[model samples]
Target chain A: MDLQYFAELFLGGLTRGSIYALIALGYTMVYGIIELINFAHGEIYMIGAFTGLIVATVLTFAGFPTLAVLVLASVAAVVYSSCYGYTMEKIAYKPLRGAPRLSALISAIGMSLFLQNYVLLAQTSDFLPFPSLVPDLPFWEPYAHIISSQEIVIISVTALVMILLNLLIKFTRMGKAMRATSQDREMAMLTGVDVNRVISLTFIIGSATAALGAVLIASHIGQINFYVGFIAGIKAFVAAVLGGIGSVPGAVVGALVLGWTESFFTGYISSDYEDVFAFIFLVVILIFKPSGILGRSETQKV
Target chain B: MASLIEIRKSFLVSIWFMFLTFPIMVIRVNTVENVIQWRWNNMIAVGLGSFLLSFVWRYLIRRKEQGVQRQEESTGLRRSIFQRIGEDRRIFLPGLTVAAVAVVVFPFLVSMYQVNIMTTAFMYIMLGLGLNIVVGVAGLLDLGYVAFYAVGAYTYALLNYHFGLSFWICLPIGAGLGAVFGILLGFPVLRLRGDYLAIVTLGFGEIIRLVLENWNEFSFGPSGIANIPRPGLFGVAFSLEAHSRYIYFIVVILAIFTIFMVNRLQNSRIGRAWLALREDEIACQAMGVDKTRTKLTAFALGATWAGLAGVVFAAKTTFINPASFTLWESINILCIVVLGGMGSITGVVLGALVLVLLPEYLRAFAEYRILTFGVVLVLMMVFRPGGIVSNVRRTYQFEGPDSGDK
Candidate 1:
């Protein structure tokens, strides 16, 4: 009955979901192609945020305009995160290509830990204040109570990224190769699709999206830290799993569901065990529907 | 020995790595003071590290490929040094005698501080062996193993806090409770596929920890239950130093028991069933193995050890907290099992020793313990998933069809 509170929670959920979707897309895309959970994706996001903060701070001190600083910071985040993602695959995942699935998974976990510490060692472990890049919109000031301008910008940017991602997957030659590879790697390789290149590109694109998400969220939250990636990565992985890991639309939808679940649960019920409740929700869903809501059940041939 | 092309590639790698680490490694920004400190030396370090490591990495990868190819081509698997030593009674008998003698004299030879450190290593050994059953033998990746360990720890802490129960009474109970929880977790994730188990267990671990953290009344919140008494013998009061030795010996005995039990279990039918289940779930079921029973036993038995270890952990530290039992703890145990050699008893023990003691002794490298663990894990999985001691499968040597006919 309370329209404002409901709208607030709804919008809040939407914002959270958008970020989750952004991070989840990388996970879903990587998992789709390789069937390996890119555990370091979250760290890549953290690195992006750190890079963004570093770039933005430097650019601002150099007397750059707000718009240029924001643009440059975001560009730096995307470019650097993509590079890290690509390098991580080449180093960790590529060598374990024919190994048991768990080996790659463990290696991914190792990579995750390594990246987390790498950032921690390089940057301060304490939370650094992130510069809010989203400017105040003149017209949206009236409705700022329900949803802030930052949230609006984040959601819109996320939506735009998703739309572009969808278009790329649907239309581009690389996208076609990616689909073919994910469907059947050997078949794609036989057709001279350059499976390795496709896999590398997938990681790059996924990392780029996650970096964009990290930049948006970090700016909105107004702080950044090395540990942020661990939890965010886990949540995003949850979202990816919730969405049917290999499916892009599934990831977005799963993220939205998870976001709403967290928002409404915290809004309506006890907030102390927010993470606990989210995890419990995941476990319950997995028990009843192991394939995930939007994911197709993979039938093992052997 | 390297070609020009290889050297050039390595140089390119160094350059790429320098550029890659440029923003984070080379730049440190202070927001409040607004000082952008450029640490350009970090770039050189990155470049050099990548350049040198790239050569070694490629060489290692090449060796691994050759090893794999050789293994595929050979009918008889080449036993690793550890395996050969294990199977050869002449060397094995002497090695066992030496190890036993060394283990018995360990506490007496070392100071209280060293004993405490050795106790900690023993704690990890117990935890690793327990997990070895689930992840290594049963083919289940239960990342939430710390939950069981937590259950064991909290059981003692709470039971002692509330009912004034002693450590002796609570040890069995903790181990029992761990098994019960294992089955509880196991029953739900039974139908799910292998990869799903890792995530769900991860969630389960987080849930347990979060519950303990938030449910202040139940788990005393994050500060945790403190001042729990150490394990006692015949109501005898011992000095702090003596208590340390006593607890160290207690851990030694329990660790030996665990090793004995796990070693036997590994050879048992149930253990074989668990192995088969791990190797191929469908094939195991086709062979009429009760996949459910095998998986459940693996989980329950594994938890029992973790539970026993947890009780000791509580008794040793005399403090319990949600923070102590984190996902990291579970992963730490996993590192030991994985780094040691998944299914090898000696490997797990050696893994525990190297992982726990080396860091303790090398105090300077303490800060980089986890960083090294990360590196070790990735490198181990990539290069030697079989670990330091590869498990040697029991081979039945008889006759081929043609040989038998001849």
Candidate 2:
């Protein structure tokens, strides 16, 4: 492939991978804290996308300027999704804290089904077109390939979110509490660190990141559906597992690798077999390194 | 002498009475619709026959319970009546007899639509039984088992469509392919336990489905293969001219054979090793059980059964699509094994029948069916975490012709 073509594919993969990384962080965070699979995490991603779409539409109808409306919609989506995530953890999962892993899994599946159907009932099942808020620039036209303005926005927004998340988790007291709770819930509770509050905060952070991802993805794709999260979620989950499910940096690395693999497969091989190629890569990786690429193997007690 | 004579007469009378009443009851129910059409003579005869049969059935059931209690008391076993009845071989006889009768008469009684539903239910039963061997017996949480089912289905479909092979000939081929895939899957993640293993298996299942969807040259892409051949018995076609009743009978025979094989496997030494692995994998390993071989065997055996079912399914539907084998299908089959009381053959069968028929029966509800189904599943999980028939233990007896040890 030519250098320009390679660069385009690389940029494309990076943008998609960033969104996946954001969602993967939620899965890994929740899993780290509770040892729960959090099957409804994908649905949370879906809710975030819908929330953004709704806010954007409402803002546009209110006669707001494009720039102002975009900013407000982004804020609304993140805040709403965080609250939704908090409530879900408190109500559905909290009661089953002491239950079997299988029971928790079943509950998560039930919640996922409930949320998906709820969306289907409330909104039309058709894919709604998401309006592009960013202005198109022609500077990249001279580079021998067309680059959409949305793609640059997606990459920048994702990077901004990731950097902000890293800073918050590294410096904030709430982040420390989250780290403590994840390491040892009972110990953290005994040490007077409000474990429940910490968990709620974790959900808030994860959900907000996922919402940001939703906005980016909606803008890039220009269309959203209730079922879009299903495939995206699975791919993100693959990313999470590839990077070692609970590791933050691992998720990012995993997402990039997955995104690149998918793009390369579609480019080199048939586009139809992209999904197959990705899954086969997952299986092969799991067989060779079950702990994931960057995951640490911990001893389990019977 | 008088007491002995009285006992013999009572036993003979009860057996003869039960035999005489069964057919009369069936005939009476059959004629009730005719009676509703202003047939006075038929109504009177049916009503009288129904009443007599009801009285006989009630009396016999009551007497059997009483006899069972007396026998339990006389046997001098310290177990309670419930325990004794569970342990008794005779209890299974009644259920088996009822199932046998239903299998025989079902095609005659139901429409072709209903028969088709039953056929699907039977296929699910086979799938559930296969899954039960892995998850239920061996206690391995395999979330990607649908991959093997897909392997079997696609193998049979592609081969039969391209090679024009007979459906029966493809059955073993499908099974072999499934077993091969099972071993391949089992080798990796052999050390992974619980959630990790489940995730890997889930990935494996997705991979298989994705491959089938993408491989257009071999699997015909999303359109899938159509007009597959059907299974025939000794060159006897199961076409309309040959009658669908014969096909129903054939499926019934397959179901019985599956049940019999499962039962035998459960009671054999291999079954014990499986139970051991389930109860404590470490201990089983320590006891020289060769955990790898056992685990692989479980996978292979389970996949093989699913493959056999796939062959039947392809022949029955005469069309195979990628949509037919999806992750949701795997989840549904797993739900059957879980709902049916894992490790319980009869429970799995009952679970399959209920889940398959419940949706059909709730057709009036339409959109609400899926919601209700999900709710029912959640409720069932909450109420009976171990499944409906989980606690029922089976005891096998080794009784030779000369050496009787009961």
Candidate 3:
């Protein structure tokens, strides 16, 4: 591959990886706290995309500037998805807290099906075009490659979100509570951490990040559908697993690796097997390193 | 006694309710015409059969309870012929006899569509039994089992298409490939347990599917290999042109053979080791059981069955595609095992029949069928978490010459 082509592939992989990392963070965070898979996380991402679409349309109709509309859409999508995530945890997941892992998993699957179908019923089954908010610029024309302005925006925005998330988790009281609850639910509860509230907060944070990802993805792809989350959800879960399910940095690295794997496979091999390549990578990684590249290995106590 | 009475009353109430609704439900079946009309009859037969089967099921329970009561009175412990049968007899003779009879007579009594469905159900039964060996018996959570099924199907398809191999020849080859993949998968995650193992298996399944899709040189990309040869008995092909009914019989025979083998295995020393591992791995290891070998054996055996089923599936369909071996398919087979009261052969068969045929029977519901199916699954889990026929409480009986000595 030429230098320019390699750079483009790397950039493309980085952008896709950033989105995966953001989504994987949500999965890892929720799992870290509750040991629940939160199978509906992908649906939440789907909901976020729709939320952004609707908000963007409304803002445009109201005669707002494109930048203002984008900001408004992002906020709306985040709020809307966070509420949905909170409700999911409260209604479907909370009652089954004391049940077996399998029971919770079944419920998660049920919730996922319910969301996917409910959305299918409400929205048209056909893919809807996402309105492009980014202005087409010729900044990368000199580099002899067609790189859209949207890609840069998505990558930077994702980075900003990750940095903000890291700061919040490291410094904030709510973040500390989340960390404590994840460490030991009983201990956290005993210490007046309000375990329920922390859990709700975690869902909100995860949902918000997923919403951000959805918006970025919608902008990149320029089309969205209800069923889009199913495969993407599986891929994101793969990313989380690759990154070590509960670690923030691990999710990012896993996502990048997955993205690079897909890009490389499509570039050198065939594009038809992009998804297949991602899954193969997951299996290989899982076999060699079950704890993930950066994840701490958990010891089982007899 | 109280619980038994409660169960009997509920069974009677459900049967009465079904009968009352039968006439109303009959109206929905009237829309289809000609050859399709047989489909309605099949539905009615299945419904009525299931209802009648419930009565026999209840009777067995009641008889076992009474026997237990007698044993308690005599031996000062709640044990009976039922317990003896459960503990001692490797084979569930009564249940197996019923299944065998159904397999034999189904082709004669049912329409081709129903027969085809029964064939599919049989395939699923094989898959579930294979899964039972791993998940239910050994207590290993495998989410990527479909990988082995894929391996078998792809291996058979490729070998047959490329080398002009017969379907019969490819069957064993497919199974061998599945076993190899199973061992490959088992080796790496041998140290992982529970969720971690499940995740790895899930990854493995996905990887296999991905390779099939991407490896265009061999798998022929998304457009899969078609017109694969069907299985033949002594050079006679089992197809629509040739005796189609005979094909159904073949499926029946294969299903019975699988059930018999699985039953035999479950009663053997290997099976005991598996159960021991499932109950408590550490304890099994402490008791001098080779945990690694036993776990690997479960994987290989389970994958072998799946592989056999996959080859059968490829032959029957005469076409194979990546879409056919999806995660959803894996989940569906898993659902059958779970619904059937995991570890119980009869329960798994019944579960497969219900799940596979329920959609066909409720064709009027169309799009809503899946919704209802999902609801039923959730309800089954909530109400009967142990499954419809969990044999945890059953007492084994001894009726042969060596009966009462123990």
Best by lDDT: 1
Error of 3 at B91 (Å): 16
Which predicted model would earn the best TM-score? 1
What value of lDDT does candidate 2 attain over all alpha carbons? Answer: 0.75
Candidate 3 Cα misplacement greater than 4 A, ranges: A58-64, A135-147, A264-273, B1-99, B235-243, B378-384, B390-406
Candidate 1 chain A: worst 10 consecutive residues by lDDT? A99-108
The TM-scores of chain A alone, one per candidate, are 0.97, 0.95, 0.95
Q: What residue runs in model 1 are displaced by over 4 Å at the alpha carbon?
A: B399-406
TM-score of each: 0.97, 0.81, 0.80
Local accuracy by lDDT, each model: 0.90, 0.75, 0.77
DockQ for all models: 0.73, 0.09, 0.14
Root-mean-square deviation (CA) per prediction: 2.0, 16.0, 10.4
**Local accuracy of candidate 3 as per-residue lDDT tens digits, A128-168:** 77888666556655642545677777778878988998898
Candidate 1 per-residue C-alpha lDDT over A1-302 given as tens digits, one digit per residue, 9 for 90 to 100: 78888888999999999999999999999999999988889999999999999999999998999999999999999999999999999999999899777678778888988999888888888989999987888899998888899999988998898899999999999999999999999999999999999999999999999999999999999998899998899899999888788999999999999999999899989899888878888888888889898888888878
Runs off by more than 4 Å, candidate 2: A135-147, B1-91, B237-245, B382-384, B391-406
**Residue range B169-219, candidate 3, lDDT tens digits:** 888888888898899889988887776687778877877887787778989
Lowest summed lDDT window (length 10), candidate 2 chain B: B28-37
As for DockQ, the candidate ahead, 1 or 3, is: 1
Candidate 2, residues A1-302: lDDT per residue as tens digits? Answer: 58777777777788778889989889888888888777778878887877777667666666899888788878877887787688678545775676556656665666666667656645547777777766566675564255566777777777787788788778998878888888899999999899988888888888888888887788768888778777777888889888888878888889988998888788767787787788788878877888888887877555
